[model samples]
Target: MKTLKFKPLVLALSVGMYTVVETSTNASPIVGAELRIVLSEQYRSMIEEDVEEDVEEDVEDDVEDDVEDDVEDDVEDDVEDDIPMDTQDNLVDAFEDQIIMSLDELLEDSDGESTYSDDWLVLADDEQLNALEQQGYSIISTEALKGLGSNLVKLKAPSSFNISKDNPSLALIDSIADVNHVYQLAGRFEPPNGTSFHYNQLLPALSSQQLRLGMIDTSISLEHETLSGANIKLHNVAKEQYSQVKDHGTAVASIMIGQKDGFTGLLPTAQLWSASVFFEHKQQAKITTAEYLVKAIDWMIAENVDVVNMSLAGPPNAVLEQTVQKACDNNLIIVAAAGNQGPNSKPLYPAAYECVLAVTATDQKHKVYRRAARGDHIDIAAFGVNLLHANAT
Candidate 1:
């Protein structure tokens, strides 16, 4: 009798019950701290209004209809004719007073409410940043995300600034002219997970074919038995740490390109580009931020992979959304897990992005996984319960 040695099968797990607890009690603005600001369209609207006023004043009431027709004609001829340079300059000159009045009115209405936080993601432009700096906010950093063309500027408030008494940033919104949107950028995505199963039957290997596949997950073990012979590339984007676990990424990579120990992946010869984005958080939960995910996507885009797999889920982020949209526009296919947020949980992204193909899980019985998130965004279902995978030694 021949004895066959079987390696232990490990499951790719998900973050089941990890929650971030807010540590700050006081809503004080931290000077020299970074905050992202989105440029608003309101400033452009105000400029358009000034242009309209100028037109109305120059034209007589009797010929107003004729003049309006000519203006519309001019708009059709050249869109830029709507808000010329002189009108824009006038708006910029008046912006300070407008923002001051707006902020004062908001403060008056608040009646000493504390709705501001020390950390914020603001939507503003260079001109707006100047106005904000004049009002005591400090510019920390600025990044113009490629392809999306959105300029995100990080700013800091004065050291003594306390929004608990007054929220000046709210008023600064008016002067910044192009402030688009503001959001608090503290959220995390759950890690991928699965169950382990053993199969005694060995499947025959299919003919190998070349494929370009990308995966964004944890680190992968390069010496794993199943992945040793596969063409796999790694890009480390997470923080370096000791005792790092590569089981999850290794299993995922195996499922995509492994062909060892009698188990074969869908594309055994596919070239894998793996991006490590998850890291240890508090020694328990695996956490990844939106910034890291965006950077991974950017890397994948640069590599021009055919299809990218995101076996993780998190809240919607503007930067991530723009990056995904740009990827789709470039004809890259994005395959994402629909998430393990439970049946009643809200939809997750980039799975929710229109350009992505959101995949959910099911068992051999064709029943949906209990923890699988369900929604109209889910594009397909796959067998994900108790699947066998190569164990990292």
Candidate 2:
């Protein structure tokens, strides 16, 4: 088994799923670049039309006001139109198949990963969904986002642009459909460089025995040598049919509480409630969802955990927003990955949420991680470039 080590935000997992765990001695740091958006030839042709239209409009607008607002507005509008967001547009179907994830070449500094779904999710009860399904609408999946009531329903429908023309009744379902968006791990593995903030200085100044830290990520390895004697308790919030990965979750947990001769956690003796939400779906590439997030956070709050660390990011959803706010209402401190999508990418949530403290990755020299997302949402930077990752045999 070859073990690899990386900082909290990103985890390297096989496409097929759960990876074996071991301490990696020769883990190579892979420098992460912003995800380049490489449009397929056909997709490019379609985008070209829209791009030209936007350019022409910009030219006209610039002619009218070549000053402050024009430049700022164009830059902002161009970004919003380019990056993958809510997919209720003419390009909805194309976005699902047209987008692919690769490094800089195809990377447009996108949301890190170009993931989107065509399913339309809305606030509806089971009876309401059943009525729609009976009337010929396609009901795909459904989930009850705990405190949000049993109102979330996933529907397979046409894009919003065609909804009124093709499925007129769907218009009455909701005003704005929350397209089922997917999120990915927030960081990448890179060669060890730059110095990280040492916990040694703060260790003596604080009482760690009582700090209860809750982590929401993949499954963890209790047997990891670094975690020997650690006070860690884990639970699986993922559905029974799904499988969980441990590499990313263990790395984060080790950082939170693992204790060893050389590697000591932030709070070595602190109690931890490790909630694993990363689960592999049979039909979808996503390992988790907004619903899973709500469940995990609710579990943490029930356990009365003081602080929560989320090493992942994705598209924002209302259920997730409500749950996160609930945590804040409980007076819990939340810190999450600021995202490694690059300097130009949009802020990823729950890190982008106002109540959460967004932390980005940095190298030993304190330089920003090459792929770290930048925006007003970012609150702090930490040493994330240098890490000892794992590879399981």
Candidate 3:
């Protein structure tokens, strides 16, 4: 008999059990001590070269598109032939690890053990939950429980339904808003500097193409003024890590979707599919677990999403690699933030994998982010410093 070895899986609490608390408390985000964004002449020269290359590539594509259009006019067009042209591939490495290091420096004096606290109120079917509870799993709260059918539950710690070593039951909730009564924390970031993105640049393009983006991040504010009128989809993979929403993920999402007449994202018409792998409290130090990220990949695969934009990184893990590979196999475009750790090519899991697209940060002037990672693995670069995002509402 042959034995197959499986990697150990970490179980996260999915259900929230709130204990009659009056108000809410969330952990503060970690901020860096100094805000530094400088690109040397050598780096500037590199950016110029890259920009030239990009222009050349665009010209080539335009010529190819013209030729293909002429061909299609004569014969039926094959969609598969056009697919690769629009697909996002060959991105450069954009690491702003300096930002993370600065954040850690700012929190140097603070204790790293603090946890974010928030609430997730879920309205569920009572009979179904009761059936689940009867199976030795405790029932936390039910939504719309008043009409004898639906109930609401306020959750605090992470809870689960059916989790085991052999079979892990992955739950797919329809929409983020459906999981009502969730208090999210906000992360403060110094928007990347250099080119100020405007809606005109990205929104009109996306709207014309009817495209949406899946932002797998920590949190988002549905009521934020900048995020007004944009289609957003939220999912809480962190389950109990609602507090982190305020400080981190919300800021990232805002950068991607925040509505400023003058400021826009790379994909403004892009609707966000928000998911969190780390809690707000965990930002004081590096996150040790990769399960939440893995689950996010699994969710994307299941949903057959167009693009998965994640701005988080950590030490590489085999499970993380496998999940990224699977996502690639599913034809999902996975874009990840290069580790902020600067010039270290040791390899950062999903970003390091051939299946994923590694994006490094550049300045508004298109200068390379000082701490951006580099190597043969790097594919493309983008602005990550002094950029603008949604303010706390």
**Each model's TM-score?**
0.55, 0.58, 0.49
lDDT of 2 by residue, 1-393 (tens): 111122222121110011112335332100012223333345645664665566567576445544544555666567667766644243544453435321111111123433233445555656666667766766666666444334566666543322334434644543223444455666554443443333333223133456777788878787777665878889888764446777777766665565665556556777888888876654444356665677788778778877777878877765467668867778666778877777898778988888787777655466776777788877666656544333211
* Root-mean-square deviation per candidate: 19.8, 16.3, 28.4
lDDT of each: 0.54, 0.57, 0.43
Error of 1 at 66 (Å): 85
Better of 2 and 3 by TM-score: 2
Worst 10 contiguous positions by lDDT, candidate 1: 22-31
Error of 2 at 165 (Å): 9.8
Kindly report which residue stretches of model 1 are placed more than 4 angstroms away from their true locations once superposed: 1-208, 240-244
The model with the greater TM-score, 1 or 2, is 2
| TM-score-based ranking | 2, 1, 3
lDDT digits (tens) for residues 155-194 of candidate 1: 5433433332234454545421111121111122233344
RMSD of 1: 19.8
Give the per-residue lDDT digits (tens) of candidate 3, residues 180-241.
11122211144333444432332232333344456566566677665666778776667542
Residue 180 CA displacement from its true place in model 2, Å: 2.5
Task: Highest lDDT: give the candidate number.
Answer: 2
- Model 2, runs deviating above 4 Å: 1-177, 194-209, 240-243, 280-286, 387-393
